[model samples]
Target: MASPIHQRLREDVLASVFAPDEPLTEAKLTERYGASRTPVREALQRLEQDGLVERRGKAVVVRTHSAEEIIDIYESRIILEQAAAAKAAVKATALDRQLLTGLLTQMQQLDPSDGRSLAETNRAFHAQLWRATHSPSLIGLLERLDQQVRRYTLTTLTYPGRWPVVLADYAELLAAIGDGDSARAGEVAARHMSDALDIRLKMYAEDPRTL
Candidate 1:
């Protein structure tokens, strides 16, 4: 489990409270988080390991990914998500399936234009899917990839005409998992990541600032 200071800093960074490339000094962080110097320093170290922060010229700052790096992250996510979905189809227990169903229902009820709510629910749904796989190694890898992607702070679901497609994808993915259809689950998960990548690249091309 992450310490409170580390979790607080991680959440702020992922939420873009600290902008990309913003410098994070130990002294300032200690004051901001009401933490002692030791915990503040340790939290920064953990964030660095998580790839959310990095050292440059002896200063720690939020990590910023190049376009190429973003693409690479998504590509890795595609493979891992595909395998996770397939494994989850075989391994998901009754409780895991119940949790997934509940999250999907929450997502479906969200207004299409409410991007923030939709994104939050979508994240929970995916996290549940990862858990359903019952593989620690795979879950750890996916969590790291997720941490890097969340630092981007933009959802592909916010793209024009994307929300409905995402809903449909989730519905199909749920159905496949519920029916124990590993092949279909894997295919849907892979396609979902591919679609997200396509939208993300398009966004970057149109306006680099949007990302």
Candidate 2:
């Protein structure tokens, strides 16, 4: 099992619980996680390896992003999701469609006030879409990229009128895949990412914390 110390640190970093580029002194981390230097070092090492934090002299800093990095990340997601959706369209079986439909149902049940649950449902929905492709390499790459973009992507539900739009996109993407319309599936996927990027860029512009 992974160390609880590591897990907690990793989650906080990925979620941007600390302000971007905030220094995480070893002493502070030890005190925060209530651990000795040894375990804290190990946990910090893990987070560093995952690119969520970086070592600066003796202190660790949460990875920060600029607007350029945000754009770059979205561009990468746009390309990958297009491919994933197209493949899913060609490859998805009835079971895959059924499972994705069930996820859509869960999304409907999610309360708009609850950001975390809504984000998970959104993530789960995308994960299922990628799974239909049955490409382990693609899934692995996307999983990592998702983490890199998580702090931004998870905010898709924060804006008023956003959830319905997101659900509509998902519905369209799912329908395209269900009908084996690879071209339409890819187009819907690209459009969905583009729409999300619009919201993401807005969030980044409105708050430095989001960028």
Please name the candidate that would achieve the greatest TM-score relative to the true structure: 1
The candidate that wins on lDDT is: 1
lDDT of 1 by residue, 1-211 (tens): 6789999999998888886667898999999999899999999999999998999999999888889999999999999999999999999999999999988888878888887887888889899999999999999999999999796645678889998898889889989999999999999999999999999999999989766
Off by over 4 Å in 1: none
- TM-scores vs. true structure, each candidate: 0.96, 0.88
Off by over 4 Å in 2: 34-36
Taking the tens digit of each residue's C-alpha lDDT, what string does model 2 give over 1-211? Answer: 5899999988888777897667988899899999999998898888787777877777789876678987888899899999999999998888999999999989987898788899988889899999999999989888877877676666668787899888889889888988899999999999988988888877877886755
User: Candidate 2 at residue 160, lDDT?
Assistant: 75
C-alpha displacement of 152 in model 2, angstroms? 2.9
lDDT on C-alpha atoms for all candidate structures: 0.90, 0.86
Overall local distance difference test of candidate 2: 0.86
At residue 71, give the lDDT of candidate 2. 86
